[model samples]
Target: MLIGIIAISFSSIFIKWSAAPVSVQGMYRLLFTSLLMLPFARPYTGAAAALRARDWLLLLFSGCMLALHFLLWMGSLSYTSVASSTMIMALEPVFIMLGAYIFYKEKTAAAAMLGMAVAIGGVVLIGWGDIGISPDNLKGDLLSIGGTAAVAVHLLVGQKLVIRMPSYLYSLIVFVAAAVVFAVYNLVMGISFFHYPSKEWGIFVLLAVVPTVFGHILFNWLLQYVSATTVSMNILGEPVGASILAFLLLGEQLKVLQWAGGLLVMLGLGVYLYTGRKKTAQSETALPSAS
Candidate 1:
């Protein structure tokens, strides 16, 4: 989980580092990730074939959501500060929690809810210190919100899908579908997928291998062990990581309010995780002992 978090922390940095079109970069990232998964996922082809038609449809739907998520979030980066965009997108957990409640009847602990509120407040401070509220940035901000909703849906569907399939097979299916979605989007936009320079291609590949493969793959694998809300909540720290990276690599400045907000975000995350652990331990203790 720690490694996955660190890998994903570099996602915005990589997106910022490249000059490629948003859809193209997203296309190759998922394209390469799907290709890499083929070797392992190929062995699970029989398992995939055994899946019901509805499951396949759900996987395709999740893939489309994932594609839109990358499209909107990466596109937003073109106009907004990384801190603003990433922090806004971090509201994904709230959306995920709401969706979980509506769709799956899942409920969260009071502590978790309080932690979410505190973390959201911190995000507001970070945004207050960073965003200018101009029309262009507002566009990016709205895009981020849309992206958050898209990803929340993806994660909600994935929580259902991953339980019945291994993470690798599920990811392979989703990535392939997402790759196709992006390919179509690129075609519609008249963007040439093969036109980028080698450096940009390298960045795209790095984006695939690092964040897409290692980061999200780990996330999918962990879904079997935790709730989707927990998985999404874990990502709230991403804004802080991305902001710090933006400061070092892109020369973005973090004002005083940003620093304070980052600290509060971390503190809230700590409380969330600690409370989660306590709950898990209590549930285990209440279970009948094995003979």
Candidate 2:
């Protein structure tokens, strides 16, 4: 999980390094990842065959959400500081919490609700600060939040389906769907695909190998061992790691408001996750024990 966090921490930095259009960059990242996984896909054929048509459709929907996430979050890097963009991404848990309540009939605890409010308030603070700096900054912040929500939906769907399929097989299906979405999007929008410099392609590959392969895949794999809360708390490291990387590599610095907002976000999310987990545990303990 730590390695996964560290690998994903470089995502924004790589996106910053590229000059390709956001859709193009996203397209190639997924495309390269899909290509790299082709050899392993053969092994997962049995798992793939076990999935019904409904499962395939769910995977496709999840992939669409994933594509939306990449497009918005990657696009946000154009207008906002890495600090602000990544901080907004940190709100994924709250979105996921809401998803559980709506889709799975999970009851949210009061403290968790408070935490969600505080966390969103913090992002709102950051967005307000960005508006003072530049409207474009606010635009980037909104895009980042949208990306967060999209990814939460993707995860919610995955939570149900991963039980029935191999993680790599599920990932390959989603990646292929996402890559196809980007391909069609770019083609319709008349964006160039093969014209990027070697540097751009290199960043694309790093995005594929680092964040996609090592980061997210490892997280999916680790879920078999750790509680979801443990995994989520570790993910909070990304904003800090990404911010530090941006400062060192890109020389991006945060303002007082940014720092304050980020602290609130981290604290609120920490409280939200742990409190919710506690409530879940208390309920589980009260119920009849499983034999």
Candidate 3:
């Protein structure tokens, strides 16, 4: 989990470092990620044959959503501060919770609600420091919010599909579909897909393999050993990790209020997890006997 978090934390930095157009970078990242997974996932084999038509459709949609998430998120970096964008992106869990409850019929306990409220409060605090009403900043903020919502939908859809297929195979199909969409977008925009420098190319490959592939694999693996609520709580670490990296490598700084906001977000997530565990335990004990 720690490895996955650290790898994901670098995504914003890497995207910022890339010199290519946002669409091009988004497409290639998924393209490289899909290729890397192909050897291991082997979607061409019997595994691919086993997937239902509905699964295929869902995977395609999920891929498109993922691509949009990246495109919007990466583009936002051009118009807004990393702190604001990343902090807004950190609201993925909130959207996830909402989607899970609405679509999956997942119930939220009282503690979870309280935690969400606190986390949202924290987000407002962080935004208060760096947020501007200027047109560019507003556009960036809107894009970031949209990206976060897209990811929540991705995860919600992923959870459903993953139940019927291996995570690797599911990821492979989704990435391939995403790559196709991104390629089309690049072509329409007249962006050069194959003209990046070697250093940028290296970062692109690393981004795909390290975070998209390995990090996702590790996260799914942990699901076998830990609860989803616990996993969601751990994801709150991404913003903190990204903020630290931005400070050290990108020379980004946060005000005292922003730091406080980060802490509140973490605390809220902690409350959600702790309360979720208690609720799960209670439900298990309440189950009727088989007779």
The most accurate candidate by lDDT is: 1
Candidate 3 lDDT over residue span 1-291, tens digit each: 778878887888887777788888778788888777677765446877988888888999988898888888888988887778877887777787777777878777777889978876776676577778999999999999898888777777777877777767777788888889999988888889788789888888878877776666666555544544456556666777777788788988878887888789778877876787788777778786532
lDDT of 2 by residue, 111-186 (tens): 8678767766665555344443578987997898899889888877877777778778878889999999999999
For model 1, residues 1-291, the per-residue Cα lDDT tens digits are 777877888999999999999999999999999888787666788888889999999999999999999999999999999999989987888899899999999988999889988887787777777787799998999999999999999999999998888878888889999999999988988899797788998999999999888788899888888888888877888888888989999999998898888888888877777788789888888786742
Candidate 3 lDDT for residue 73: 86
Evaluated at residue 2, the lDDT of candidate 1 is: 75
Clashing pairs in 2: none
Candidate 1, superposed: residue stretches over 4 Å from native: 289-291
For model 2, how big is the CA root-mean-square deviation?
A: 3.2
* TM of each candidate vs. truth: 0.97, 0.84, 0.90
Top candidate (TM-score)? 1
What RMSD value applies to candidate 1?
A: 1.4
lDDT of each: 0.89, 0.80, 0.77
**Which TM-score value belongs to model 1?**
0.97
